[model samples]
Target: MPPGRTVRFSLSLCLLLFSALTGAFAAPVGQAEFERGVAASQRGEHQQAIQAYLQAQRAGFDQPALQYNLGVSYFRLGDYAKAAQQFAQLTRDPQWAALAHYNLGLVARRLDQPDRAADHFEQAYRRSDNARLRALAASALDRLPGTRADAGTTLSATVAAGYDSNVALAPDAETVNLSDNSDLFIEAGAVVNHRLSADSTRARYLFGGLHLRQYLDVSEFDQQSLRLGFNQEQILQRWQLDLRAYLDNIHVDSDRFEQSLNIAANARRTLGGGRDLRLHYQAGLIDGGARYAYLDGWEQRLGIDSLLPTGAGWLRFGYQLELNDRDDLEQNGEFFSYSPTRHSLFARLTLPDAGHWRYTLRGEYRYSDYDDPYRISNGTGTTEVPREDHRYLVGIRAQQRLADRTALFVDYRYIDNDSNITAYDYARHQVMGGIEARY
Candidate 1:
């Protein structure tokens, strides 16, 4: 997800609360209930606030402010259907229409209806009077899976410079000692998306991106990549379906490294309490850059991503199975084939925000096993042995908001890889600081 899109949603929610606090509702008999609801909402008692709001509504209090408060309460209570209904009704009021549609879009996104969400966000963008709110709405619209053909296209770019302690990831102590070199690198990427469909329930888009990276002293490790893709997103009740097909090309050290054509499909279902489940499958045919085509293969993966709430921040986890079938010849003119299975686990702990600074700690582990033996030649002999590897990674990042559309961040990461093969064991550490801006 883009930071601009996420921040826009947060800002819109704050505007909703601000409107509730400043707007007045006229219901002689329900005045007390409305006041109580506002107090309860402020105190984080969303269910109690919902009850009071419902009572006020029952007492004939039907105003934009009342409806907006009720919608926020329902959203906090994880009742998106009721929240959407409440906000949809507020779209008739000229003063509240834009914000109401923005809230509806947020609700639609939570319900896994990306197409409908885009429609609501576009409406909010077109109808908003506040420049900031309009910009936020436009940002949100750009991030939606797909949009109507008449909708505008989005273009974004990022540039960063960092230093790496170990570029090649080689073992520290071995017959062939690992080479360690520190170098500064710069990376940049740009992406553009153009909508191809006009329907809200079913949308399609064409996307293209280019990425390039260069190391100051390690020019041999420089990389460049290009990707062209098409995406289709559909909403069906409580489920969202995403289909993508892409062609990717990569160049390393100014030489063609790899090229592939891939197709993927994913299904996402939103659950209560801000949880979601996603399942995906991808297939690709890869061609390698080597002279003998040793890395040419068919790749396939099946994975699931899940989110669960914790006392503090949410916990996101994912698991995947990958298979690579090599269809090339080895150096000795023998057909090479191997099946590798990998398991990965990850967790992140997001601490409570302190003023303008946000902090996160994350950890990941991965293990891989190879079905066939890999032949390795040392000083004296050559031996074939099944390969196994374990990798552990930990990272910490802190971000400070510089403005509504920009932030500064510093991050540090450590990685350790242990393998049965001595040449593959390595450890690395990296530190980077950068600024991110959105437009």
Candidate 2:
């Protein structure tokens, strides 16, 4: 009785009628061509069905059933022009007009003529006598061009406050006196996206964001960043492609610390049933300043990921291969290269809203192998050996919706790093709560 259930049932009935209608058609006592055409159509030999149907027409069979099957066969064979003509002819028959219009709507959509498709679907919805046909038509009209995929401008803002178990800088193997301090921090960010151009098959956009983070007791560790980017996306049949380029500037203690240019290409394909598979590649050229200059170089990543509908939400999992080629630098008269090849596996699960609340859980594991040996000094001598690291990260976030465009969230993260180098071993915990608003 519910609208959703009614529509689903109608859809199933529609498909069954379309595919099995052959059994309902009666040929004249001597006219076997129509029967042959029906048998061919049921066997999925659409081309052969078309020939047999033409032969039946030549034999004086002018039934609506014959015309409808012809239209379906043409549409399935990608001959939209002929299919449209056939459906147009059937629209003159009172009993078959509604279904004819519905089929015409499908053909129009395949041709990318959304306005025409909407018109046909509306006609089918308004004129049909059968409840099932009317329901199917209404559902089609509701899913017309005015969808969430329409391009437009959007802006959002976020503010959060959190505590970090360790605000200390990341350590090098030789930096034995690294601080392991804790601090309270506040974060604020705003992002905007403006559509540059859009059509049914593609879109271009410009995007930018600014973020700032400050520590209550460690003023010198404050961070800020600005990012600007361009993105283009296109759909070709079943595949969606994306290209992006961005520039990023980062500051520490109000002094410029890093600048980077990043470019990426991505492709995604639907696997049906609310599932998708994606492949992506990204490259970044980074330049570091002052005490962080040794980090200057390039990094690249290749990854594949998939999303599967789980109940009402989704589960995403992926693997990435990373190459970080940083400069070799001398510190205290010892040379070291920070280059590393890394393999990472990650997964995330998002839960559908329960009342006003939603949740997500994510985790990652990474293994890193250094390209060159790291130098270390002992009481009696110095030695060099490649450093290896295994890192684990897990996080959870919960959000409560306050309105259509606003939500409050709490996030928690834990990270543990195990490395052959003693100074690199550490564990950290961070927790944050935030309000986000979008328009």
TM-score, one value per model: 0.67, 0.66
| Model 1 C-alpha lDDT per residue in residues 324-402, reported as the tens digit of each score | 7765445642223345677777777765446557788889898888767776665576677778989999999998877
User: For residues 123-143, what per-residue lDDT tens digits would candidate 2 score against the true structure?
Assistant: 675455465666676666556
In terms of TM-score, how similar is model 1 to the real structure? Answer: 0.67
Off by over 4 Å in 1: 1-151, 173-179, 332-339, 350-352, 378-380
Best by lDDT: 2
